[model samples]
Target: MSGSPAARASNATDHDAEQLRALGYSSNFDRSMSLWENFSLGFTYLSPVVGVYTLFGLCLAAGGPPMFWSYLLIGLGQLLVCLVFGEVVSQFPISGGVYPWARRLVGKRWAWMVGWVYAWALCATIAGVAIGAGPYLAAMLGFAPSSNANIYIALVLILLSTGLNLVGTKLLARVAMFGFLCELVGAILVGGYLLIFERHQQFSVLFDTFDININGSYLPAFLAASLAGLFQYYGFEACGDVAEETPNPGKRIPKAMRMTIYIGGAAAMFACLALILAVPDMAKVIAGEDTDPVSTILANAFGPVGSRLVMAVVMVSFISCVLSLQAAASRLLFAYARDEMIVGSSLLKRLSANQVPSIALIVSGVVPALIVCLGLFMADAVATIVGFAAIGIYVAFQLIVIGALIARAKGWRPSGQYTLGAWGLLVNIAALAYGLGAIVNMVWPRMPDAAWYINYSMILTTVVVMGAGLLYMLLAKPYDKGTAPAGDAWELSRSGSHATGRATSQGFQQAQ
Candidate 1:
């Protein structure tokens, strides 16, 4: 039986190789991504999702009028983390991102554990995007009441996203760029419309505090309220996942990371401010009474047609977000599989002729499909999945920040272009604090009859998922020694004599 299992593994590897050859990708597929394309893709990853106005109501529900302060705090915290990511990504611009950095900073064993955890985190994120995409699409179609229909709609969106990714990276990048443009235009229009027509609420209202009964503790209430706000800043480091495909990744990756942070951050803050000013009664909006705060605000400012237009724009933005996330998550899975960290490692590593991680893309699509199917068992599955996914992502973010701190302590700094200066230490400390706080808020237990039992499920599932990674490390540590460092493996594949493995354009050489 052992021999049979070994034979099956060999067959799988051979099949993966055959798929890569058919896809027209050389073994050095990692070198195909250009710096500009990488930056553009990264920008899209952070841009479209800035429309958190609809969900802002939930934050208000959690924290009352003081939710704005939570947004500011979370934004500042994420900026610190982004600074850390900028420093690390600029130094080691490999595809594995945190996993590779963790390996170099700590030891290979710890690195594998980090990589496995990070990969699963990204996988959960992709599932959340898929689940979220359904409702956004359903709203656009005017199907507001049917929960089951929305699940099917979400599954269809996931499938379509998979098809686009499987087609090629160039196509994916082009679509992402277009989506970025739509997000930019939509933000400007929405903000301007609100400013011109409905600028009544004072800025001071944002900082004003109000008390609520939340299991009898104000602090817990505040934390719960801030959790929703914190979710808005979750994907800033997404660019790091695609480092392998990025040209001059060392510089471009950091630039993209920082730009996304500042641009997306500023845009979201302004949009939220505009939203607050436009609404006459923030309390009514926060009480879970308004079904569509964004559309209502726009409709009040403009008209029914105007509201539809804004919804259309928001739908486009959500689509762009889904597309960008799908690409990022698939690449992450491909990177892990290339390192043989997963069960079907060889298959997951397959690349299309266009240098896209086609097999991984298909695998990612399957995950969301399964999650959508779970909707059949419960109406709140989407919310649960998203919360669980967010927890996974936050956990990975904490690990990466911890890894970055270790690297800094060891006097390992990336030279040239985006260094964090003397403030690197300070930024790391702030990021660590922010990450830990967010994790705590996300997992803090709620009352038995709370609206979201999914939060508890998320906490439990994240623990199990992470535990699986530890188990994998214990079982696979012996074989991992034979695999070359990610940097070296990338370099060898690019320089080798294989016809498809030759490097094309180059400015900054990869670490290998």
Candidate 2:
């Protein structure tokens, strides 16, 4: 603590590494990312432009103007979840996010299931975010936006993002920061223009449902439309996913997580509000006649050339989102493989000269590409695909929340730079309740007249993914092979030292 400023910073990094070692891991990642870069990663993953633009048409059709409120509702709920994650990551500060936190908080088996669900969810999210960019690219290029064309474009984006991700962690952080700036500034400029010069509706219009109702009541459709918000609010957890790569992660990552929710949520709501107020034909959108309301609104607000310029910015945001998602997924794979929990552990755990998970990145891109190919057989199912991704993540999140609750019940108190203290239990409980309710709202079958798979896509996909993981875990017993410490055993030895801001080799060995 009594060194030059540079040496002090180096000592802090050493302390971060020591904390990881105490948790039974030596630092494998580069650990060069700053707090800003880490937050950029989370912000880009939460990409407001990507979320609002992709879901605006669907939400408008399903719940009319009132659907805009979903952003506020879900933002508040996810804030609670983010708080719980902040405390978890601050204490554990490991890579693989929810999985490691669950492992440390509960047991190896429970963490394996969380990792299994989280990995697939991230892959699905990669496909969904990449595919969502296709139509925008098509429109900007003046190409006929057919299923084949969109598929081709989506594949191109996936490959492009994957290549960028494999280059290096520094490049990834730079691109994410650039994308965050571009997307946020573009959203503000475009949304501000629409609100100032192209407003076509009153503020009161948000409360008007335009007579949209389900079963003689509007509550059901409102709940269904909440998917718009639910999808937009996540990706904050990506901050913790790369905890190993960020210096002082136990302190920095939590602040980055909160900033992500605050800035990302506000930007999403601002863009959504401006678009809703500027909609040239709300009735047309709500009636399902205007399938591409976002394009229509932008074209009406800005001329064709200007709209194309804006679409280009949107493309960057989408690619950045894909890049972040791919990085996160590959890290989870690397974490799993490092613990010898997955099938191709030797390969997936290997790091390149750049300290990047090159092979894991390739697998991450491949899985999402496979999911994108499904677009050919099932057209216009982007919403369904993204819905499943949301549910998978939410379910995994709740697993961590439950694990933390159980750990608390057994006398586990967080002793990190970030802790909730007396509010920890209450916040964790609220997060669990909100997560459960959101899962129900998202997984409920709303398309009864459609094909059964289409109607129950989220539920079916979740069950299949989880069911497969369970079968494999039972048959293979991967949890038994894990040699790392788990179930908060480190706390019993190091909790006092952690509170005193001292992590010694003795504490690390004792925890082991």
Report the C-alpha lDDT of model 2 over 231-290, residue by residue, as the tens digit.
Answer: 899998999989989977877899999999999999999999999999988989988899
Error of 2 at 172 (Å): 0.7
Task: Report lDDT (CA) for all predictions.
Answer: 0.65, 0.87
On lDDT, the candidate that comes out on top is: 2
What global local distance difference test value does model 2 have? Answer: 0.87
TM-score (all chains, Cα) for each model: 0.83, 0.95
RMSD of each: 9.3, 3.1
Clashing pairs in 2: none
Per-model clash counts, in order, read: 3, 0
Off by over 4 Å in 2: 377-386, 489-512
RMSD from true fold, candidate 1: 9.3
